[model samples]
Target: MSAWIAAAGQALLIALLAPIVTGVTRAVRARLEGRAGGRIAQPWRDIRKLLRKPPTSPEGAGVFFSAAPVVLMSTSLLIAATVPFVSTAGIAGSADLIVVVGLLLLGTVALALAGLDTGTAFGGMGSSREMTIAALVEPTLLLAVFALSTRVGTTNLGVIVAAGASDPAAVFTPASLLAFAALAIATLAETARIPVDNPSTHLELTMVHEAMILEYSGRDLALVEWASAMRLAILLGLLANLFAPWGVATGTTWTAVVIAAAVLTVKMCGLATLLAAAEVYAAKLRLFRVPELLAGSFAMALLAVLTSYILA
Candidate 1:
């Protein structure tokens, strides 16, 4: 029962904090570009307004179009529950690394199918680009995680983090450093950041994730947008907790839990700020250039795995 409560709390926290992360990124980007940004709560406001509006399914669209948002949001919540943020006691057994990756891919596929169901040119185009990126990105993500799993001898996320925490120096080793780099690149690509796909842009030709949901309005759009933000937060949180694992609680002590929560928040803010800074300075790559980025990430993962084996 305690474990269930902790997992539920973490899920709620992810949903609420996700928008703030996105807002912080936008605010930082605006400041860098010499413009005044909207309020930090602007995303929350946008979502609230969107939910108040009526949803309109385009002509010829099927039930999948309506079903996509629910599935996406549910999947994101599930991933959030599985990732250890403040405590590992609740979720360690149920969510292995591979299962987390699979959940993310499943969300991507559902969104892509929703895009296709709309039968719009922009939707189809976005679906194609999204799937292409997914195909390239997932293998790199898996390989990077596999590198860490190999060193720790478990594909379980919680165990990997526990092992790393037991030996802090493990994160500074060659294999770990390389894996972090690879995961960082995968993060940028997975979150549809600049140099991969511009999150702020709605241009059909360049948009990958956003273009797919162009037809959704009202509550459906709100749900999808909120889910995307939650997914980003979950991924960033996992990267921080898994790699650092300094303050995260292994037991259920209140003090340890509080410290873990605080550390996770600080880490997330730092990562979000870094992402904003990168987006401000970076240009979006051409569609054809995406494969090169993924390929480089793949090489980094492979290197990490090899380094781990050689060092061991």
Candidate 2:
């Protein structure tokens, strides 16, 4: 019963925190660019306004278009609930790496299908680009995490984090450091951040994610945007906890859980701020060159796996 409550609380917390995460990144980026940015609560305001409007589907849009938002939002929520964001004592015990990766991929595919359903030239183009990137990204994400899992002999996320927490020394090895770099790059690409796809860009030529949602409005847009924010937050939280699970509660104690929750929030916001600062110094890569960036990350992941074997 305690575990169930913890899981539910984490999910609800993440859902609420998602917009703030996005807003933080945007605000940081804007400030870095010498512009006064919107408030940290701006994303929340945008989502609320969007929610109050009615969505209009493209003339030929069908079930896929209508279903994609729900599917993406559902998978994001499930991942948020299952991953050990705050308390490792709860649902984190069952958080498998493969399952989390699969859920992430499902959301990606559902959005791609929705993009195709629109039948617009840019929609299909964006879907193609997204799938191409996903092909390169998915492998790197799996292999990078696998590098960390090798030490513990299991791909269970909770076990991996718990093991690292119990033995902090193991988290700083050559394999672990290499895996962290690989996963960080994968996260940037996976979240459609700088040097991958710009969330703020609407230019049809450079848009990958934005193009897919060009046809959506109102409630549908709110869900998609909200889910995207949640995903970014979740990945950052996972990255922070996987390598630095120091504050995560290992027992179902309210005090420990509360402390862990506070730690998780700080980590997520810190990561988002750092990412935004990095983006200020970076530019989006040309479409053709994006694959090269992803390929390099994949190579890093491969090396991490090799290093793990050699060291182990």
Best prediction by TM-score:
2
Summarize candidate 1's per-residue lDDT along 22-86 as a digit string, tens digits: 98899989999999998778999999999999899999999889899999999999988867777
TM-score of 2: 0.98
Show pairs that collide, candidate 1: none
Model 1 Cα RMSD, 1 decimal? 1.3
How close is each model in CA RMSD to the real structure? 1.3, 1.0
Can you tell me which runs of candidate 2 are displaced by over 4 Å? none
lDDT of 1: 0.86
Write the residue-wise lDDT of candidate 2 on 100-141 in tens digits. 999999999999999999999989998999999999998999
